[model samples]
Target: MTNLYTGCPKMKEMDGRAVLILFIMLTLVKTEGLVSVTTGSDYVVTRVGENQTISLDVSRAGGEFRVSFNDSTEYLFHKFNNSDLKRVNNNRTLYRDRYRVRGNITSSVFRLTLYNVTTEDAGIYECQKFEGNQRVPGCKQLLIVARNPSQPNITGPASAVSGGSVTLTCSSSSRSLPPDHPPLTMNYTWKRNSEEIQGGGDVSVDGPNLTMKDISREKAGNYTCQAKEEELKSDWSARHVLDVQYGPNTVHFNETHDKVTATEGDPLTVRCSADCNPACTVTWLDTSRQKVTSGQREAVLSIPAVNRSLSDLYTCHVNNTHGNKSRNLKLDIQYGPYTVQFNEIDDKVTATEGDPLTVTCSADCNPTCTVTWWDTYKQRVTSGHREAVLSIPAVNRSLSDLYTCHVNNTHGNKSRNLKLDIQYPPSVKTFSDISINNITRKVDSVSFLCVVDGNPKPSVYLRHDLTNRTYPMTCETLSKSIYTSHQYYECTHTNENFDVFLHGAYSCRAENTVGHVDSRAVVVTVPSK
Candidate 1:
């Protein structure tokens, strides 16, 4: 039966069967593979001060395959898996496993946005493809970086007036953010020394300036400007120095008065003053320039009357917390132009003719002055005399003259006239005595005498040769006598009658309050019995 049927329908059945086989072959997947993934660009460049952009593309085809963008980030790409996709493996799920229509092809692409991109982003990025525990492709690398920002410049004043405002400006030549990501937010910190300053609401972001109002002395110091973005902080700008100054508060002098001489019944005034801020203290100084009592604030110092004894240097001192100043003035007093007493004169005098005679006229006055003497002949004689006499070789009847004497001092000058006469007496007598009394011996009593007769009586004394002891002689006037010797202990006097010290010499000296006389050394020895 089977043989007969196969022969009868061969042509018709063969054509139908061939058509069905062709349809089945057209619907079936012939091969399983993947084409390489690609990006919009293979290379990327960026500067430190600027930003950049990049896009990723993955165009490939296969049966039941899954695609993923393995970014450097652990979370990988923000996923966009088609809802109809199923799990190909534990690590990758089937996305677009089966297309709805036969021969219909499609591709998947991803966009990555980075903010504040830096050199750290320069590395490899994986672009992987998988199908049911199989790998079709691998990841690729993308580079990113930033160009260095320009240095900042700062402008400001060294010092601002007190209670005035000061402004500091910090700017950069090229200021920008990277374009690969959104614009970065920048941070600014204003500082003095190392301390950050607190700005009022007056801060402005765009200008990066710090404006301080009502500046005071405390507001002086160094300043710095800093700009920061992400993890990068910019360098500080150059430093600035400030100073403030002012003055003229006080004045003073070392002295107050300036008069050298003032007569009695005259007026006087002195000044002691100083200039200073916050008012200076005024004080008077004595000749020593030391602060003295009695100082008043009178534009001019006035003394009602002056006397002869007020002579000294007066000083005015001005002082303040800051410093001291001083001024000096000299004051002198003067008085008296009169004389009080006259000179004394002897009533009689003896002189030879044409002999040189001398007389003195003394007077007391405000100032010492000169005196003069004259003769009755009106001829000027030797000046300065209380007693003046005229003489001739032998008193001629013409040997007469009225002598005039004058005395003067700073007080006033005066003159007086007087007559002089001459007389003579027997020759004045004086007595002499033996000068030597050198004999040395122990004596119970001794005798010596000196006698003289003149206009005045003269006294005598007895001195010991062995000892420098002097004894006043008391006896009837013009009498000579002997005196007994007495021993004294603890007396400064040493006697030659006593042995000399082992190594010392002994002598005798005699003296009156007016004159001295000494005797030669006298050696004495004891008789051994």
Candidate 2:
């Protein structure tokens, strides 16, 4: 303490500036000697804008104290001592804003606390003890390390098309440390959406630069980076958003089961949309391939009334300048039966009797119409299906009738007629019984008649057994019945014996294109032979 005023003028006589110079010079000389002779060294780490309380070991140092801060240079940052520390202090404003020391003036256990530490504060610190204004030999060597780097920034393409490549980089200053210690060393780590990311096939990392290949929409998110140096680290960088521009990925329909359904004479509506980046356009096409809506993100198709003709395919197309896609939508328009008619374009179906017969009835409708076959008597005889099949294993003329094909839906109904015409061979019937006839000499001029029935009147004939031939062609169609034919064989000559009479055997034959039939034979005999 005597050395501070040994050669200096009285405190009131000297200029304040000169007094400060002398004090700082004296502190520097003492600190220089203490650092060169001190063998113990300590360390401290702090972040910028943060306060650090270094627990310096001043227990070895006693009495008055001298604290000096340095950056390993010839000059010293000056000092802090017990007396005149704040009392009558001048030009020591650096101590008030950046540092504060607290302890009893006579105590050796003192603490140093740095306020709002900055990058420039990283340096060496020296502490020397004194008693009776002479050096005590106790000393300490402290190293302060400060880390403050510029806020990390990420630069890269803000947006890109799918399947394209992308590159990004994180940058910050590395000279955050002071001159006392080595330059600040930093390593970079990247994260996306707050989750750490590694480098591999899809992503490549080299130092601070990160690259991504074949980028897709699924890989888009917010990215950030951090600068790290050993245990010290800087705050995370500002978020850099990566948006991948792409065309419409897929199309979806608002309708259920991807289909539109409506009953006959009812309204219908269909809607479609797509997923894309820049809001894609949509187009709705009808069954005729004509656009119903175009150049919109969403589209709708409306129909006032629905029918079988309106049941068809529709298309929903979504597109952008990059590409386009289309999906087909089916409109199942339901309705009652229509265009009802029989098979072969004829209302009548002609078939031979005793042969299999089949008749079909159909109509155009959506959801397939419920069909039934009804006979002329209004009897439902056929199974229900899209089309009616009236099947008969063996058909006969008795089964011929007019059949109706009836179809019905919740919306409407319709009916069609089909005539079943069954044709058969001629059927013959004889009127008189000649098998028991006793034709004697008195029974002259006896007659036989026959009738034949068929679709087309068959030609009728009479035959005699004795001649074994159709000798008499006397059968003719009846005047009263157009389908009937008659035959008469008169007994021209009476005979005494069964063998000598014309009544020995008589028969009738009826024939048409379909087939032929023969009637029962008649025989005559004499009594009391």
Candidate 3:
């Protein structure tokens, strides 16, 4: 209130403060240009052999503008001012053929395109506007990211033998990168049959090289490689197939038919096989461990004719580069009954009447023949396995005949004959019943008859005990009967004289090779005339 407007220093100070505030506002308004620049993202990712474009929005600004691209590593790829542009340092030679700038300088939006990007182009890029020597405060920062590495290639053997070793290498090419660019730093990963491969046991990995030791069939599969750098990963490489070779594990027959059967003098054969990658050599061995057939590719063993000696355990041996195996089978040969003979005390079997008789037959055979005994009438007497016997409980003249033993089997048959003889002592039934005329007169012819039975013809005679005289009797053998042969004997006295008084007792005697028998004594009566 002390006359502020009239030469007052306080008013002068307030005025000075207001002017300074206005000046500051004006300066700020002038310093901020009408141009606005914006970007959607700070970083971009791309792959090699692909084109990429970095977009920037510049709006509300008038007059010519400039945009430049640079990296934190001081690699400046491009600089454009209106229609004129220049590439800096050696970067010009690197990007002059592959880089392009699009959109007019007068447009509110501009783009920087890169053709066939490479790992060398991965870095922070700066887009700036410059008027005279002063640089605008607002600038766009572009982070160009490189794509993943190129697809890797694998080189190695396509097939390998089991227990062998192999090596595989994974490699990639980056022709799009700058010549001065450092080697790509990549992490290598391997896969087998679409599964990740871990380094252990038979598998080993060193950088891009993969080695397998003591390879087996289990390790055979499709293989591929992938390369990764930072957060980027490459596509899987082409599949490489590996084949593993091995040998057979076992040798044997196909089914349970492991035994072979054949008849003597017949052909026989056997076969065996094995599972193997490489073919195997087969050989046949006899029971004595001697080679029956030479080594051949086919698994077959053949014999022209089978014999008793050929019937044994045969061995089949199979061999290969990896290992060897063997199988054994039995061969059976069938033969007929042979060498049949009768087992008897002598050629002619002898037995007493009413005694037991037995004759046995034996033969040699493979399957043991079926022995059957038969008489001369073709009747079966006995049967057995290896031997046969014909028995008669009480032998008589009826049983004295020839016997045969027949031995038969699957092969053939054989027979043998045996003779049987029956012997008996002399036996007399009646001595007075002999056929003779009745002695009625002294001159009449009187005779006595004796009936005897024995094996051999027995000698007959009549004896007179009182006179101590013996008169031989004539005997005749009749036809053979069931029991034995009968013999008839006759003793005659033509004249009845003093002999009647001397004949106290008369007896008939029969003798043979076995023993002798005597008939009852009888008296001769003299009738009164």
Candidate 4:
């Protein structure tokens, strides 16, 4: 049997017989895992400062035993026939103060404990058992792991812009071991705000490095890293806060009332704000995109008194290094007509009795004003937009009065007045259904009636059509109509001897300074001759 202690090991030969032995079992301290086995030796694994105890099944042991390290010739521990442990100062292997022997030969049980195990103490440890002249082969290697890794440090910039890329690296180390052994394999883990980071998409983890592309503001936070070597964990690295500079977002407004509409001359005030890192800049823009008010993160716009011109358009803009944002605000003013007047036509209009006339009024107002043309009696003549039109296809003398062009809205109202005068040449119209002067010859006296219409009470007279332009009969006004230009008049021509000489055509003529028009000739005839 060869012991773990190395002073140049010497293997004892089996006397022409092959021995089947797999009895030596390795046990580690605190950590649980499978022990690797190779040809002759089993392996035990543990960390520094932990005790390593290798167990031996002594059911087949001889009463004599010896423990060794790294196949050494000198014994690390020795016992003979249930006696006390032997001194281990043979200039080889582990010292006596570090290892201890326990169990009794009669009990057929044995084990060894290597105390204060360090990286320097890593080697193959084994116990040899002798049964009379025969030897028992029992050996195993004890591997002492170095201490946990040092605290890691993450390296990267303190801040980054949104939509850009970011790369961070972390590094850690621990105590070294002899060149004869393989170094411990290390694994890295990342955390953000104390939550484990699972890499995918734009974010990726390659060993100790964390890489991210097209970063957003939401991904900004404290980041840390930890190192793990063979079930041992290192402390988390210091927190590295990543500040993301981004444009404005999540806009809001503050107003006492709904700004969609308001009365003219009303006081108005509105404020705009948004969320951003590094405090975004804010400004108020006009409909033309001209900057009006500038501020940081928030902006205020005020109007002491609103007017129709200031309605309709307002915008808020915010921006930073990453991008910009804009939003439109609604404002409408309700106001009465202000610029109301006749278009080309004046307030006072004049037209001939038979002439066509058209009068228009124009008005400007907010909230779209409605225009109405009212007559003297307050009757609605026409209605439309502020461009109200009043048309008289053919004007008469009666169409001479004041007309109103009214423009109104929900806020208030406005009106304009226009007076119209109509003039014409007088014309006589026969009254009493007598369009023509007709009389019987037997009738001693004949009377004719006619209606005269004129603007200035024209002179009316009965004329004999054949008597050299002479008004031979009397004509007078009987009654003058109060509502119209109807003047009732009667004209008579009488003769005691009714003859053909005096029976010439008689007519009525109405003449004014404008012109004159005559009626048909009167007739006299014998009845039933």
What TM-score do all the candidates reach, one by one? Answer: 0.26, 0.52, 0.55, 0.63
The lDDT of model 4 is 0.66
Regarding lDDT, does 2 or 3 come out ahead? 3
Separately for all candidates shown, the number of backbone clashes (residues 3 or more apart, or on different chains) is 38, 1, 2, 12
Locate the minimum summed-lDDT window of 10 residues in model 1: 18-27
lDDT per residue, candidate 1, 135-217, as tens digits? 32432433433233455667878766555677887764333322343334445677777778786653333447788776665
The CA lDDT of each predicted structure is: 0.41, 0.61, 0.62, 0.66
Q: Give the residue spans of candidate 1 off by over 4 A.
A: 1-261, 288-301, 340-529
lDDT by residue for model 4 (1-529), tens: 3333344233232223222222232343332232223212344456667666656565454445565556666655555443434544555444546654433323345555667667767766555553332244544545545557789999998898889999989888854343355555678899999999999999999988899899999889999999976667899999999997887766677853335677888987788888888887889887787887979989988888988777377888888776788778888777888767786867777676778888777677777789999887788999887577898899876653678888988777888888776666767667322322334544444455656666545666667667645444445666754433344545543444444455566677777766777877666444533
- Give one digit per residue, the lDDT tens place, for model 3 in 1-529: 1211223222111111111000000000011111112123333344555666655454422233344444232324222322223344444566755644454323245444667666766544444333342333444443334446789999999888888999988886543233333344567899999999999988999888899999988888999999875446778899888877677677766453667777888987677777655678888888889987745454667788888866389888888787778888888788997678776465578777789877778787778899998876788877999887777788876663677778988889987767677777887877773322444444244466777776666777777767667677766555554432233333333322433354346777888897898889876664545
Count of clashing pairs, candidate 1: 38
Q: Model 2: what TM-score?
A: 0.52
- For model 4 the TM-score comes to 0.63
Top TM-score model: 4
